[model samples]
Target: MFLGSGSFISTTKAPSKEVAKPAVTAKRLMFLDSSITDSSVEVLQLPSPASLRKCALYAVFDGKVYWLRGIKPNINPVSLFVGNSIVNEDHFLATFKFDVIFIFTSLLFLKHDKFISVPQRIYELYRSGVVDSEECSVLESGMLALWNHNVDKVQDRLEYLCQKIKSDGSKDPLLKPNIDSFRAMLEHKVQSLEKAVQKSNLMMGSYCRASETSCHNHVRKNYIDFREGKLRLFCWSVISQMLNPEARSHLVPAKCDFNDISSHLQSTSSTAPLITSGNKGAKQRKITVAKGTPSILGFFKRT
Candidate 1:
């Protein structure tokens, strides 16, 4: 049942069989403020109201997220926020669309899907009270997370290949055999996830992320296992990190034989403009901008 705005609800770090303490106002649930209503009720706040949707969610477990306490964590663990748009009340949700759900007391970086199956886990924090409108966004968050997670693994492997690259050696470090060797586990997982996606576009879409937070709670239960979106476009790049050579660790040579080459590289990196490609098979274009003032010999300089 939906509590009216300003009515606060109370939650524990984990669902505990407490002796049914007096009910607390839902203020701390929807609104994050320094004002204390029920001293016992733990309040969770985002680093700032702007963290909504863009920042990782947290809960009572890591109460006062982004703030480091002692090894034990001094902040209370009952409140978690994916993002906060307000400090005092639902000025943001009541004003615009109410996007956050304040059911669970603790926050979690999605360990489960929208269903939230971990009875003992904090992902359960995000599992509660997800509405129909949010289904896709939730799915997208999970999809985005998993996609990034997969890409991170590839990028990590690519780190080893960095600086190891000599110009005479293979420029395409991500060759088939190399890609095959590193991406086996990722490929298998993607294929497994794809099979999980084949059942329905409802399964394949970006809308309504199927994050299941609890093993016990059954909300769109089937899709929770596979919170994937439009893999065809993302699989290649994510699985290979082929496009991001700069992310790898660089291996600078201890001795530089070519001073001119080093200077040329510095000039190119400093002067290069961003290049962008147009839609399907269009020529790439360079976006140039003047950095420092032109040298006095500018009149003869080639364009």
Candidate 2:
């Protein structure tokens, strides 16, 4: 009886204690894991009902999360999301990185989806004029279209107030001030639009000159490479020479051992794979052999 009891006690007690370890509760955090097939991108719904009406989703990418708003055209105002309704005048959503806040009522416009970087870049380029007139026009047109829609709403409110004053035949003390405020706002918007157009022109000039310089440099380098054949040096030397007069001598090739030269070329060739390592500071080097005859060596830095 004792031997039989001992065997049962050992099996039951150990198994029961092992199984009794607490189970971990997994929190509903958004995950952007590429390892799992379906975990590359995920949209998380917010908790608030008013905010839910807009159907905003938080997109998870790598470790960062971005908010994506759904926009319905001809039904929603683009300004509602990009402008003061959702984001503030400064376009900041909230104090924290992921905190999203809504600032209006009546779902006045449809939510719109856009890459956060795109509009911001366009705004900067427009303000800077680093793009062409055609490209700048398109950006300005889109911005104005959105701005007009928002301004139209404001104008409509002003007109309604004017009608209210006419119908009542009574001067409300605050009505005149409100009308003046709206008029000032309209003028401010017009000035902003003008500034955007002016900035675009400046940006275009800079962009064109930069593009021409790049093309000229590229052609010059190619000519040199074609002339040198297997003895062509790295393009970084040319760029460095352009940037600093002192670095000009560094561009010249010193007599290096044949094995060292071969090793350096191999190392440069291997550097291409490091570009996609998600490192901002990584450098990538490329050797383009024109007609597979080993002609040009280019080293590009990725920041």
Clashes of each: 34, 8
* Native-referenced Cα lDDT, model 2: 0.28
lDDT of 1 by residue, 1-303 (tens): 111233322222333555543223323233222332332323222211222222222222111211111111122112223457322332221111111211111121122112221122223233444523233344334423322343234324433422222333433222111323333534564465465445654332221233323344443232333333324323322222211121111111213212233243334332212232223353544335355433212211111
* Deviating ranges (above 4 Å) for candidate 2: 1-54, 59-210, 214-217, 220-303
Q: How does candidate 2 fare on TM-score?
A: 0.16
Q: TM-scores of all models?
A: 0.19, 0.16
> What's the lDDT for residue 114 in model 1?
24
**Per-residue CA lDDT of candidate 2, range 1-303, in tens?**
000000001101134334432111122222222332332344433211122122223443344434433222233222334334453222111111222111111111111121122223224534564445433454344333323444225334533423222323323211221233433443344355345434554322101111111235345221110112122322222222221121122222334222134355444443223212223453433434334231111111100
Question: Top TM-score: which candidate number?
Answer: 1
Model 1: residue 4 alpha-carbon error in angstroms? 17
lDDT of 1: 0.27
Q: Kindly report which residue stretches of model 1 are placed more than 4 angstroms away from their true locations once superposed.
A: 1-55, 58-181, 200-231, 234-303
List RMSD in Å for every model shown. Answer: 23.5, 26.8
Candidate 2, clashing residue pairs?
70-111, 71-111, 76-110, 77-109, 77-110, 129-203, 129-204, 130-203
